[model samples]
Target: MKPRTLVIGDIHGGLKALKQVLARAEVTAQDTLIFLGDYVDGWGESAQVIQFLIELEQKQTCIFIKGNHDLWCEDWLKEHILDKTWLFHGGQSTLKSYESLNDAEHALHLNFFERMRLYYVDEQNRLFVHAGFTSMHGPAQEFHQSNFKWDRTLWEMALTMHKHITKDSKLYPKRLLLFKEIFIGHTPTLNYDVTIPMNGCNVWNVDTGAAFTGSLTIMDIDTKEFWQSDTLVSLYPNEKGRNR
Candidate 1:
């Protein structure tokens, strides 16, 4: 089989959904998996998700990009301090998930989080980031690193200019011109009433809202082919899963 480069969206601790999507995608060790982060904080298996990914990395080529939720989890792992805002947004579930992990396992997961990249630009000039960057020059030139994990302006601009403006037009966004394509996952497509990956201009958003009531997605970057799991609410029926 030919090697493939697959981009995955946010897991939000839905380990079952993540597993289902990977199986549906028929992912192989020969493929390179680029995960868009948010591995924790939503469902009840954040720790399990991290552990699974850690094991998955041993056999498959994987690129992990850090997301905003992952950053908050990392901070708590390192400092033992919980942010009220984080708790309100789903950190409580993550905290409960970690209760089953030993100190050694926690240390391993922390190391995994610390090693994640803010953004990655491929040799083909395709950018894979957990979220969007603000720099017109590219993510490397970004002034505020946090934007790499939290900015929505880039995606918004792409949507607004999608088919309205041509690349040659003076009104075209300089930031959009920097990459051949961009893949991201901070924002969910369900917000716009979509369950599949959403495309705007050269940007593709793969987050289909697995944290709440949607599914987890994995896409083949070259073919734009994608696979998704069943709705998270159905997978974990008893849990609210960040729906609150």
Candidate 2:
């Protein structure tokens, strides 16, 4: 049997938490790991988390989706100047992570960033994006690239729906109907007072708030079986994550 596809949420540089979730998920060489982005910022090991992910690719199939923060990091890498807004939102930690890397390592990490996708849709029509998708006209590619990593309307609309029905349902975003399932991780589930993966209108939000007080989540796309780490702060006991 083929290994399952595990879609993970925002990590925010919580290396320990990332490791814990992966171990709990029982990921194997046959498994496909799809990271929903925000791999850096917030915690002390942002740099290490990226390096760990790079190494993991050598053994497992890993798909990375670019997030808003990841885009900020890209800008910083090219300009070598920190944007104030980015700095305000835990960007300092990402910079700190890169400061420890040597020249060659920096290039490799940059390559990883450059290779990130705005969104990934598998053969099964399972859509994976860092944030929510916008527009009711067509598929993810029809919208702007930023929409893939920054829009929250998809999840927000799902939240307002009374149930999770898919066929002929007017309560949810019509664009979502294009896929069998849509997986995203930008809007943390913690805001809903939940720390685990959540489902609304056939959309699954796996970001259990690893950047805040919640844990990180990794869910099997088909079975919906999932795993979560302890509160992110617990993973990095010594550091205050984004002071959140």
- Candidate number achieving the greatest TM-score relative to the actual structure: 1
TM-score, per-candidate, Cα-based: 0.99, 0.94
RMSD of 2: 1.7
Checking candidate 1 for backbone clashes, the offending pairs are none
How does model 2 fare in lDDT?
A: 0.86
How would you encode candidate 1's per-residue C-alpha lDDT over 140-225 as one tens digit per residue?
88999999999999999999999898999998999999999999998999999999999999999999999988999999999999
In TM-score terms, candidate 2 sits at 0.94
Cand. 1 TM to true fold: 0.99
Candidate 1: deviation at residue 27, Å?
A: 0.7
Per-residue CA lDDT of model 2 for 1-244, tens digit only, reads 5679899899999999999988887788999999999998899888899899999999989999999998898787766768898898899988888887898988888889999998888998888988876667644445577888788888887777737554675654677678888899999888889978888877899999999899998898989989899998887888878755
For this target, which candidate reaches the highest lDDT against the unseen true structure?
1
Off by over 4 Å in 2: 139-141, 164-166, 169-172
Error of 1 at 123 (Å): 1.1
